[model samples]
Target chain A: MVTAREEILERLERARPPAAARPAAMPEPSMPIDPMATLRDRLQDAGGSLQFATRSGWTEQIQWPVEATTLRHVYSSLNAMPGRGVGLSSKTNHDLADLDVCVLAAEFVVIENAAAWQRPGCLRERAAALLATHLIVVANATEIVATMHQAYARIAPSDASFGWFLCGPSKTADIEQSLVLGAHGPRTMSLILLSD
Target chain B: MGHRERAREFVADVDRTRWHDQALWFVRSKRDQAADLVPDWEALRDQASAIKRSALTELPELWREFEEHATAAGTVVHWARDAHEHNEIVAGLLRDRSVRHVVKSKSMLTEECGLNSYLEAEGIEVIDTDLGERIVQLRGEPPSHIVMPAIHLQRAEIGELFAKEMGSAPDLDDPTELTDVARRDLRDRFLKAEAGLTGINFAIAETGGFVVVTNEGNADLGTALPGLHIASVGLEKIIPQQKDLAPFLRLLARSATGQAITTYTSHFRGPRPRSTQELHVVIVDNGRSQLLGRPAFREALGCIRCGACLNTCPVYRRSGGHSYSATIPGPIGSVLETSRDPATHAELPHACSLCGSCTDVCPVRIPLHHQLLAWRGELALSGHHPAWRRFSLNLVAWLFVRPTMYRLLGRFARGIGRRLPPTLREDLLPAWTRQRHLPTIPKSSFRELYRERQRQPKRPRPQAQPRPRHERNG
Candidate 1:
């Protein structure tokens, strides 16, 4: 009896479509003169916000007025953000439901969609950013890329296991098309752009 | 039942029907706003369609490349010829680990394969984590819409269901309140489940990995605890290169919803480092290869499951997704259901007014209306049309063949139209006349008018210059 794979291959061979030429590479549209300024606007559109801070002062600036809840900084790189916050582990996955705020460092940020890239090491407990009611990321202004293409190109060196392009806080419009934040994830995502 | 009967039933409640129509129209408007933001929107769609075309043409090669790379990345790859085999492979994976509980996030393929029922029959409990999916699962109904699984339901209906299932407040009708209830209820299931399954949005052959895009972040949460992550992907989801994801990613969120991007676009290259985690990809070909064999219907594979076609479709917006009575619904579903069983889905092709709005909004530019037309022709050729339709069509064809007869018939129609009352004319073609007016017949036929003009010499009236304002007043 022919295997499913061979059968499928045979059918595909029989059903070959007519030859079609590959589309020419699309030209990237020109970016705004101030990509960071545009990025802030787009971030707000996507239910995320941003604040500018000095590189050294970003840690000090990471403060939330919401009281009585857990705050986590999951990444191991202390010098990256220079913060001392509660850490997240796999064991915390069960109890992170009440997490109020989290501040971690993004590998790189995409300006077009305001997506923050998180590589594997810092994202060890995947739920750290997601479970929190509010998430804050501090990244150097130099790490911002103009588009997703640029962001994808920069991921080759990270050896990421579960890399992500987190655009905004978790949201859902499934209920009568009403936009609601904090749907099984962070209600707010605030990025601190640390200028050198 | 035919689309007309089902759609009529769906629209029986006029107020709810209007609400449904406005709701989907809102989504379509949002899509327009998001799509306009990209200057290269059409270019991205073109590239995406072209990439999908090549991917389908060279699927056998890409599948092998994906498998090779995925296996080398410490991921196990499995192939299933059909739904039964696909369910068995997943069941086998779970049995090997003695896993009794599984958490799943919005994989429509599993719904297609009847995986949940199959797993439950084998004594494993499965929980759907997506807020919309969980709602319909508790109600024991299939997803009414592909993207918004419970779109057919109202918030009050959901509130009632949640009250019973999740033990929430009985009178809870607010969307956010109900959503919070679901989140609190499913949080423990995500952490305790032994295995997690998700659907693939795009499977990159170059990296031997896949991407799962979700706004709720349920997939990430579900797979965080369980060391085993099983991604059930259709063969058509495979793209030739990793870079090909750029155009698809840009179009997906904009077309699906108005969002700039989904909250999370998670790229799982391999299983995480510890906890004996493993990434297993089951690439299923059930009926897809057969679809690939038909050139006329081949473009359907280019669909990205955005449901933009559904939102813009007048028929779908009015009739609702459930009226199509297929796993996937709306214009795309109408054509796709025909492939599964043309006789059963024969009425679906007739559901459209053929306005072609679906094609206009399609991210991959699948000629959905044209495909539906083809399905109609094929169905007619197969003699699946009702006897009255066949007879009427034959009568029209016969009348058009004879010039004199056709002219006489036209004259008779004009005479009848002049003599008949408006209400009688509406009864003649109830379907067309129900919501619109019939056109008035002209006093004379075009042929007669042309003959009369030929009998007279052509005369040009004197050109009149425009009068000044004072002269016009005088």
Candidate 2:
């Protein structure tokens, strides 16, 4: 008996068109003259905010709640802002549901669309980015790329089990096309650019 | 009912029809703005089209390569010949894990296969996490628009539905407050789900991975929290290389909603590292192979599901997506649905005015209006058109060949048209004049005016002036 896979493949084999040559390499769009400025504008358009600070002063620049009691459960993997760390422990994704703020390091940032490439190290860390009320990504100023083409060339699929180009906080315009920020993920996303 | 009948029903609500048309036109205008920002927009569309064309020719090789790489990366790959098999495979996976609750993001493939209802029949609880999809799912209706599923609805209608279902305040029609209600509701469902199911946007054969794009990040959150992830993909979603993603990723969001990019463009290679988690992929070939074999209609496989064609389609914008009554709506849906069942969807091809706006806005350059035109011929050949329509068309064709007969008939029709009362003339072609007024009949034919001019004397021509020597030499 032929398996489903075999049957489908056989049908495709029978119906396949003649092979055609792949087109020449896609031409790269010219890089923006000021990538950081472009990234800031694009980020703001997507309902995200961008801030700049020196490497040492970046932690102080975050707009932490005026009342410390408001942020009860903060999850930060970076050593600069200490919080409850999931680390390499076997923390289930549900354990992070009540997370207030999540701050993690981004591998790089893309300028064409203000997005940070976040490769969470553990399952809990990955879920934290979505479940938290506020999400912050820290990236160096020198690591910005101009387009998705440049971004893809920098990373490989094998680098992590899961990765994402997170632009703004999750948003929806489903209700009569009215833009609503914070649909299912963090309500606000801030990218802190460190001037190294 | 045929498209014309359904469209008539939709257009009966004049205010709603006007709103729907303007809403889509607004999105189309945004797309034009986004396209203007990119200097190389046309080049990207051409490159994306060529890459997809090349990929379709060797799908067998691409899928095999994808299966191998995915398997090697600790993801299970399954194949289904049709929608039924696809549903069964997904249900069996959930059943094996004893998963009572499953959280799903927007996967049109699943909708096409009726996966939600299939799972529900098996006593499995399924929740659509996307805000738009959940609204429609709760309302027990299919999505009217691909990008904005609940676009056909008004905020007041949603407020009422949520008031009844989610226990929100009555008459609370504000979008922000209503979205907050759904956000909190879906978040709890996301945490409790045992499995997550998503649809693939782009399946990279070389990397043995897939990418899912969403603005709300529902797919990411749903899949990240659950131990088991099952992604359903159509066979046409495969690409040959990783670099090929650049052009597609660039065009998809800009064309879909005029965004620089979606909020989340997630890439999943396999299960979570060092865990017993599972990642399963089901590749479905539901009439896609047959479509690929067709020379005239094969390029449609390149669709990235952007919905730009829908936004720009005058018929779709005015009539709304539900009028088409197909899984996917608008110009592309007409082509795909007619090819699958010509007898049933024969009216879909005639739904277009052949303005070709869809082809111009298509990110992959599918030439949608041309294919819709071709479907008309195919349907006519297959005897899908009504006998009366065929008879009338044949009569018109016969009259068109003979100039004398054509002119005589034209004169006779004009004479009758002038004598008829205005109301009677409007009622003569009720279908055409129902929503429009007939133009005033011409006083005389163009041929009569030409003959009249020939009988008159011609005016004299002006004398040529002499040119300077330097100008002449140059």
Candidate 3:
């Protein structure tokens, strides 16, 4: 008896249309005039914020809530901010559920949609980005791209086990099409553009 | 019941029908604004369409390449011949691991396979994590719209549901407060779930990776926290290369909800490096192979499931999604459903006004109206249409070939129509004239007016003014 995979593949091969040459690629769209300005505007439209700071001053510029000093649990993977790290050897990801703030580094940012490409190294790091109340991503200002096409060309899928293009904070318009931020993920997403 | 009968019930509620229509039109207007921002929107659509068509012709080789690469990346891949097989495979995996609780993002493919009920029968708790999907799941209802699953329900109704299910205030109706209630409740489910299931938006054959896009980030959280992840994909979701993702990612959110992009577009190549983590992909054919074999209707397989066709369809707006009674409900749904089971869904093709709006807004340019029209012909030929409708259509066809007979019948009908009272005239076609007024009958047919105009003298053409040329004078 034929297996399901073999049967399905056989049927597909029999029913497939005659192979044809792929179409010629179209010309690329022009890049934005000012990538930083476009990224700021688009990020604002997506309900996220963008700020510029030097590598030395970026930590001071984050708008931490007034109560954050005593109760906040900050997890930073960057070299500048050496916050307390979660136990990576934990068996499950549930340990990071109480995290208040998480700061990671993005490979590049796209100007057209204001998405930051972040590749988390492990399962716990990836879960922290979603489980925390606030997500802050820091990237070099020179790494910004004009569109998704340029962003894809810079990265390979095999380079990371998990990767994501996070545009804004988690949001939903599911209830009567009313825009609501902070739907089961980070309430706010802030991107810090480092100059140094 | 058929689409016509189900649509009548929806139309009976005049206020609700009007509200639904306006809500969808608002989204359509937003899509137009988003399209205007892109300078090469049409060229992008052409490129996406060409890429999908090219991929369809060589699906066997692409899937083979995907399997090899995915296996090397430590991902397990499965194949299902139909919905029943798909359900069995998913259930078997969960049963082997003793996974009692699973959190799933919005997966229309699972809805098509009836996976929820199938898993529930095996004593597994499957929770839908998307905000809209969770609402409908609690109410035990199918999603009315693909992108906005609960668009048909109002805030008050959702509030009442939450009060009953989640212990929220009975009178609370604000969308923000209600969403918060759900967010807190779903976060608990996410923490408890042992497995996560999602649907694939695009599967890259070159990378052996797939993308799952969402505005809510539920797919990411659901999969990130859980050690086991299973993704269900239709065979047609395959694309050739990673660079091919650019045009599709650009158009998906803009065409769906007028967003520049979804909040989270996560790519998964393999399971996490942890020893306990696993990633399983089920590639199901169902009836897609038959659809691919059909030359006239094959383009419907190119759909990216953006739901733009549903938002822009005038008929779909007035008639609620429940009227179609399919997992996907709109212009594209009508084409796909009728093709899958022609006899049962014979009336679906006639549910269109053929305004051609759906085709204009389709991200992949599926030519939806043309497919719907072709379904009509196919159904009629297969004897799926009623005998009376077939007979009447044959009579009309016989008369259309004879010019004299057609004109005489038209004149006779007009003369009789003019003599009858307005109410009596409306009674002749009650289905068509129920909510619309019939136009007043003219004294003469169009052919008669044309003949009389031919007898009158034609107006002389205005004399052309000759151009003054220096060369001619010289």
| Candidate number achieving the greatest DockQ relative to the actual structure | 2
lDDT (Cα atoms) of all candidates against the true structure: 0.82, 0.88, 0.88
Better of 1 and 2 by lDDT: 2
Query: For candidate 3 chain B, which ten residues in a row score worst on lDDT?
Result: B427-436
The per-residue C-alpha lDDT of model 2 at residue B460 equals: 85
Please list the residue runs of candidate 1 whose C-alpha ends up more than 4 Å from where it truly belongs after superposition: A62-92, B411-474
lDDT of 3 at B195: 95
The RMSD of every model to the true structure, in order and in angstroms, is: 4.3, 4.0, 4.3
TM-score, chain A only, candidate 3, equals: 0.91
Displacement of the residue B464 alpha carbon in candidate 1, Å: 17
Candidate 3 positional error at B394, Å: 1.9
Model 2 agreement with the true structure over B321-428: per-residue lDDT tens digits? 888889889999999888777888888988888999999999999999999999888877878899977898789889999999999988888888888777787665
Candidate numbers, best DockQ first, in rank order: 2, 3, 1
Model 2 Cα displacement at A104 (Å)?
1.8
Model with the higher DockQ, candidate 1 or 3 = 3
> Measured against the native two-chain assembly using Cα atoms, what DockQ does each of the candidate structures obtain, in the order listed?
0.60, 0.82, 0.81
TM-score of 2: 0.95
User: Which of the predicted structures, 2 or 3, would earn the higher DockQ when compared with the native?
Assistant: 2
Task: Give the TM-scores of the predictions, in the order they appear.
Answer: 0.91, 0.95, 0.95
Clashing pairs in 3: none
